[model samples]
Target: MDSLTHLTNNIPWQRLTTAYGRGTDIPQLIETGQYEELSSLIEHQSTLWQTTPWVLMILLQELSKQKPEQVSLQEIQLYTAVASTINVDEMDSQHAVETMNELLDEKYLWPEDEEDDELWWEEEEPRGYDQEAFSSYFSYSYLLLKDAIPVFTAIMEENDKLAPAIQELLLMLQSEGERAVE
Candidate 1:
């Protein structure tokens, strides 16, 4: 198997987690070019983790290494998945909706006893937040995307079908203050 096929299997997934679960499923999903699964695993209703950008960086590096003439459907799917995953929206309404859904699912809005409801809300407030870690994730994501631009540009030149989406991704990367405010 190619190195990319085995890339995820080699990761220390025990120490990492995605929006869904342990990171073990990631390598297999990417290797198989399961774009839908990958999107669900990393994109929809997901919270950004410290390891998220690292995974994206590795995937982009692997994708960028493929020769344009040899670009496969699987490669394109993987590229699209990674691109969608890292393209953070300037307005994070999706994240807000996810948070609201989680709160509802956990019944955080209604307590078993009214007396304990206030305490629940108080405890839910984030404490000791790590702003640096959040910033680092975005910074790393930006740097990785910047490094992959040349490779993507070359690929886009060869694959016109991918040009528009790739161009959008490049623009997104170049935009300043694209990060969502917490």
Candidate 2:
């Protein structure tokens, strides 16, 4: 059997849990062409578990090997779900602002007056989630599946439903690329 088939069949679903329930149902969900169910399982609110990215990588690899004309809506939805989970647009703006602020600080330049600085610092809340783990997963997933991007892009171009998610994925890829080059 192919690697993708092996992966889907062999994932330790009983020990794994998604936003909903046991992950064992995931392979069946994909096999049965249950896009919505798969989407819900892979993306739970603002949390993308480590397992979700692994599943997504396998799905993308499977889809990428297929002819462009043969790609299914369920597959595209998989891409959309993965893109939504990453939520790169939200991260992009926030990261840009933070990076800009850091650069200014390093150069001894302040964008705001002393009072504004104090107010902003006071308002800055501690992140309640593990941002590092999320970032690491996102970077690793993108790098692992970068080769499949063009396939996703083609799907996005032909289907309006995929545009938003594909766009976010592209933005994340671009941002990651820039960071790599720097």
Best by TM-score: 1
lDDT of each: 0.53, 0.56
Q: Clash number for model 2?
A: 0
Cα-lDDT of candidate 2: 0.56
In model 2, state the lDDT of residue 14.
Answer: 42
Give the per-residue lDDT digits (tens) of candidate 1, residues 58-145: 6777777777766655445544554454545542322232221122232222323434433533663421113434444444555566
Model 1 pairs whose backbones collide: none
Model 1 clash count equals: 0
lDDT value for model 1: 0.53
How far out, in Å, is residue 135 in model 2?
Answer: 4.8
Which residue runs of candidate 2 sit more than 4 Å off their true CA positions? 87-136, 154-169, 176-182
Could you give candidate 2's per-residue lDDT for residues 69-123 as a string of tens digits? 5666666656555665554434533322222112112222223233354443354
lDDT measured at residue 75 in model 1 versus the true structure, 0 to 100: 48
